[model samples]
Target: MDAEQAHGPGGPRWWRGRGTPWRSTLLLTVFVFVGSAFAARMQQGERAELDLFARVLLLVACALLLWRRRYPVAVVFGTAVAVALYLGAGYPYGPVFLTVAVACFSAVVAGHRRAAWTALGLLCAVHLLVAYWLYRWLPPSGDAPASLGQELVVAGWVVAIVALAELARSRREQWARERAERAQAARRRADEERLRIARELHDVLAHSLSVINVQAGVGLALLDADPEQARTALTTIKSASKEALGEVRQVLDSLRTPGDAPRTPAPGLDRLPELVEQAARAGLTVEVAGEPPRLSPGTDLAAFRIVQEALTNVVRHSGSRHARVRIDEERGTLRLRIDDDGPATGADAGGGGNGLAGMRERAAALGGTIEAGPRADGGFRVLAVLPVKATAEGGEDQ
Candidate 1:
């Protein structure tokens, strides 16, 4: 049974929104009254005659169940007291035990096991006092003392009911823990995915927009004096904007249809020539050393974005017009180093804080590390060391 159902309605039809389970409790009430009346008939000669007081006691026990979820400790004790009174009145044993069992069950599952046990223990003690010692003062005159065997049987029954309730409480707690863990895991995955998207967007826009900004400036500078040169700058801006838009569309498409393969493959080190060409159009010269190596898609994309952002920073922040990129693989790791001989344009010229942070995030996701700062000489350098082989577990595309 669901843990919520333990405190509320029986099924969808019985559901009364988030309120008390009136319908199901009413049913239990009816069942207890009918069953106890039938048992009274069966024990007519052996027990006291059924009376108004006996029915009222049964009603009291069953009615307390209605508030079991709200006040479990009080309900269990209230039901136990009512049932003990009915027993002291020399009432027959039947479904009368059902009401107290349910109350104890609710209390235990609601994290009031000690209270439930205390109530149950006191009720059992009363049963013993009435059955074995106080029968002379109670109804059903001339009744013999209850046998040790019968008392033992009653003890066993109470133990079984409490044992079952304890088992239910354990299972409910386990299910709750598992549900919390699953929700936490889902939230963690969502946070990671959002971070990944932000990095992708930043890399795509920052690099392309930096190029467009440089070209637009050139176009404005030579618009009248050099018409052909202005036209060339405008052409470069158009190409950069078009490429940036396409990449942005790809990123948004992933959001629209998650889990599907991307229509355009993600950029990687194989696109280095294209990156170099774009930088050249922006009037920044790029030098490449060592051939790009085979890498897992995630590491490849991280490496590509790191170099792209480093070069974009050079174009935007560094006064130097030249940047060098070196790629090398050793053991099971790929290393990328980007360097610019720079007199930085401003104090905050280290790739706009977000760009460097994104690089660090990408490297950390791949169980890699990034080192980026000004060189001992008047220059800035970014070095990333990433594992060459691993499932692209941290990347969306792979």
Candidate 2:
């Protein structure tokens, strides 16, 4: 590889700061040189006497490791060549092999397995030639040929080192994959949470504000003509505003203490009376048909919101002054349908805003579906079908 590619980002932890292995390589060089000097003294009259040339060869082999983290393939072969020359010159065999092993291990872990193996094979071939045949010509006069058993033992050691490097590489890759998966999961949860909060705020404000808007208009038009009726409209406004603030505060509390139980139970079909009362204040008469079935918490909350958004749409967008809410259950499913009796004025006819979209999302999140449009008769309707048992599979058509 080129120098730029070799020294690129994400090389390895060892090459993290300063992007060099200078200190470690310098220490290894000193250790190998000093250790070899001790081995030369121990060999005494058996091997060639330690000389300036032999020391230089040892330094070259260890120094090549300085680039092992960057140019692993080049460093592996470079160290092998230096060590082969030292052995071919009949220098005493000591800590010199450590340099080649370190270089080979680095090359293998850096995904240059073929280069590391080729360098190792060449070094072994050179050692065989020098020990058995070239000894008569090159080495310190009368050196004997190496035994077959000793060669086998050295070959096994090299194989074990390569295997260990392969294992380490596998583990590093596995850890990287796990970390990526965890990060992706975290982001998915955050997006889901943000969408949920947006839905809650939309439902609470839309319904209450629509009621307050109608009452405020009534109070303005009748302020002087009928003071008692205007006073009643102002009172209705106060009640709607207070209820809206309470629901908003409840939603915010859940955000502040994420895992804790809500201070008040979530609104459900059980609160249908209160919802109807709120709609009455907006001048919409609602009739309830069919009983609400017991459902999972997620299904219950979604059912309530669908009803609320549908009624709010009627108040703000439908010209109808009357609406109908029908609830029923069959085959472990809860079904809700809200209908208004005339032509739509704005968003209820699918013109704009997230009211209809939020209702669809709430149903889909609980493994349900929402259908909304103008009826063949003379009005707009919203129909939602939710599984009584909660699930996160989004939804499927009924």
- lDDT: which candidate is best? 1
Colliding residue pairs in candidate 1: none
Q: In candidate 2, which residue ranges exceed 4 Å CA deviation? A: 1-49, 63-78, 107-137, 142-146, 347-352, 392-398
Candidate 1 lDDT tens digits, 106-223: 7777777778899999999999899989999998898889888878878888988889998987887777678879999999989887888889999999999899889998999999
Judge candidate 1 against the unseen true structure and give its global Cα lDDT, from 0 to 1: 0.86
TM-score (C-alpha, index-matched) for candidate 1: 0.89
Each candidate: RMSD: 4.0, 4.3
Q: TM-score for all predictions?
A: 0.89, 0.83
